[model samples]
Target: MFKPAEGPVRLPSGQRYLGLDLGSKTIGLALSDTGHRIASPYQTLARKKFSADAAELQRIVAKEGVAALVLGLPVNMDGTEGPRCQATRAFARNISQLMPLPIALWDERMSTMAVQRMMTDEADLSRARRAELVDKLAASYILQSYLDWVGGQPT
Candidate 1:
């Protein structure tokens, strides 16, 4: 399921790519449009045990007809891998074992910070609102970047 995407990925109609921004306490989810052109914030799942989390993700994948997963990889700003990155890699490996889908590990440096700044500077949301919105929004940002990257690839 964790096959390398050497070529452009094609999915069946009505299927989508699911983006995940994994946090210690919660996992934010974004769902790509069926056309694979846009991603939108879907929901936030509070983290439990790994098995429980995987079960919930599997449920969502089935419900949304997810074709693949784009998991945010929290690499350091210096382009170095760290414990967070290791944790993400492990999560991806575990999730892939649970589901049959190609997984893309997208660099997510500062994704949460970027979303925080947007909420503060542009949206002018209150602190509580920003806290409530940051996770899912970050997932969207990660997915959008992945989609843009794929778009830039030559057909």
Candidate 2:
């Protein structure tokens, strides 16, 4: 029964946040700085059984001192919730049962495409290399978007 968080994300002092971009086959991860002002690409996790994936995430949360989770919500361009959006919500709900961290869903339309374009236009990375890096980079983009939004809020 987990719901996407409303308003600004608040956490205990000294704790960071974890950003997740969940794909059908892989999960991209990003980590925020202790001050929650910056997000960096972390790692990618291959999809596995729900229990195994949750266990790994729990372990990472403990190790990384993560206080909250920002999950990319793949809404359609028309602002409609598609199957992918439903799946992401389901994952959030299920993960909430396993871990008590607050979860926020950020609209992720065009996130991966934007990252791919950046890699091609600026980084000039090869297709194969971009494939290897896109997911994690996209996760960073998503997390950075959230951080920027928070930063713009009136304190």
Q: Would you list the clashing residue pairs of candidate 1?
A: none
Instruction: Give per-residue CA lDDT, model 1, range 1-155, as digits (tens).
Output: 35545555656657899999999999999999987789999998999999999999999999988998998999999999999888998898788788879888888998999999999999999999998888999999999889888777786
lDDT of 2 at 109: 93
Query: Over all chains combined, what TM-score does candidate 2 have?
Result: 0.97
> What TM-score does structure 1 among the candidates reach?
0.93
Q: After superposition, how far is residue 71 of candidate 1 from its true place, in Å?
A: 0.4
How displaced is residue 25 in candidate 2, in Å?
0.3
Ten residues in sequence with the least summed lDDT for candidate 1: 1-10
> For candidate 2, lDDT tens digit of each residue in 44-114?
99999999999999999999999999999999999999999999999999999999989999999999999
Estimated TM-score for each candidate: 0.93, 0.97
* Clashes (N, CA, C under 3 Å) per candidate: 0, 0
Candidate 2 — what's its lDDT? 0.93
Where does model 2 exceed 4 Å of error? none
lDDT measured at residue 104 in model 1 versus the true structure, 0 to 100: 87
After superposition, the stretches of candidate 1 with alpha carbons farther than 4 Å from their true spots are 1-13
